[model samples]
Target: MNEEDLSVLDTVDILDSPLDAIELSEPDSATSPPDPEEMLLLLEHPESTQRIVAARAFCELKDERAIPHLINLLQDVCPLTRVSAAYALGRNPSPVALAPLISLLQQDWNGYVRKGVVWALGNSQDTLALKPLIKALKTDISAVRLWSASSIVQIAQLEYESVVSAIPPLIEALRRDAIAPVRSNCAWAVGQLCRELPLNVVYATAIDALIEALAEDQDLGVKEDAKLALLRVGDPRGLKMIEELEQEGWI
Candidate 1:
């Protein structure tokens, strides 16, 4: 299976199963948590691979109690360790870790770290992270921006109100941002926001942005995104602008 499939496998049967026997020789109930030392051993191994292995171990175990220690590893010099820590902590999201993860989402520059943060945010399903994730949707990197958009869609589906407010910012970004990746996120976010709050006011506001984007935006991705957003709003002016761009061979 793929890496994603493996992560799924790592997560399977965690919550429902009896926890691993503390001593492995004696038996405890399914809910009996694993020994902290055992988890520490994995993380403290000399090799970075071993640390990643340990991180995955915690993730598969689905122990919400281990979030803090895993988060501390986010700054590890090893990229694999840092990303693994993020994945592990995300899978085991707890109240204590929520704020820290949101901050990490805002500050992390590493693409893999950002990817892990977005995935964790989706797993946590925290409405509080909506604004930060929306901000991340403006990241210059395509991978980071796309993952942020995907996270917003997931969060919006689960809890719409907190994320619904993201629409106006997204529309504004789509209209004016020079970065193609960020503009694409703005377009996708606009679609997701529309699902939650289909206010005519929003469509009207977004139509103007899309019209300007189609007329003046230089990037193909942003221009195409503007076209798609315009189609959604049924803006005749946007359609005319798109046709003009096509005629000019700019699209």
Candidate 2:
């Protein structure tokens, strides 16, 4: 991962601005961070605009009280409302929202809504998120697939067994994902997961993937990320490959 602690692996960042569709308009710039109790009321307001603003408010609010309301809005007729609500649930992250979030991710037609849902599921850090996230990494649209790689890292931090489960998909994505950034994310995730694993088949497999990318990937950015992953994991095989590649003037 990067030099910033936990950010590379643990943070669920949306590179593309999915929120651009529902930017919050602060009613009053004067109030230092608005009132959640009042925002909660607005959450169910009749107007779709009101609901969008209210849902977006909870994105910064993090009040657990908004969890159920946000979950309800997951099915909103408006894609913008549903997307905002998904993001708010990500900020709040209640277990109650997990199944609903997963449901939305699987069935929602809007890519932005599904992207937000993927982010919430990742931030929730629930084991149940692992399978869906893996599916997203493998099968979703590029934007969603990008977040899925990083989110898998978020869950893998919880346990060793989870790390074991996470590595294969990550390695698979790194080796074959068509998008360069998605593959780069998989590389970063693989390196971060390696920190949790002992020297074993899983560990060796991860190192092998990184080395392969470092040597063979077409994108220079992807190659640099793979090189960084190898350096971070500090596997002998990876370190040796870097050395040989440097000696041969290939890196």
Indicate which candidate wins on TM-score. Answer: 2
Report per-prediction Cα RMSD to one decimal.
10.7, 7.3
Give the alpha carbon lDDT tens digit for every residue of 101-207 in model 1.
Answer: 77776776555566677767866777877777777766434455556666776776665465446666677667665556666767766655655555577655656
TM-score of each: 0.63, 0.89
Error of 1 at 152 (Å): 3.3
Please report how far candidate 2 places residue 211 from its true position, in Å. 0.1
Q: Which has the greatest lDDT?
A: 2
lDDT of 2 by residue, 113-224 (tens): 8778888888898999999999999988777888888889998779888999999999999999887888998999999999889999989889999999999999988999
Candidate lDDT values, in order? 0.64, 0.86
Task: Tally clashing residue pairs in candidate 2.
Answer: 0
Q: Which TM-score value belongs to model 2?
A: 0.89
lDDT of 1 at 107: 72
lDDT of model 2, residue 222? 92
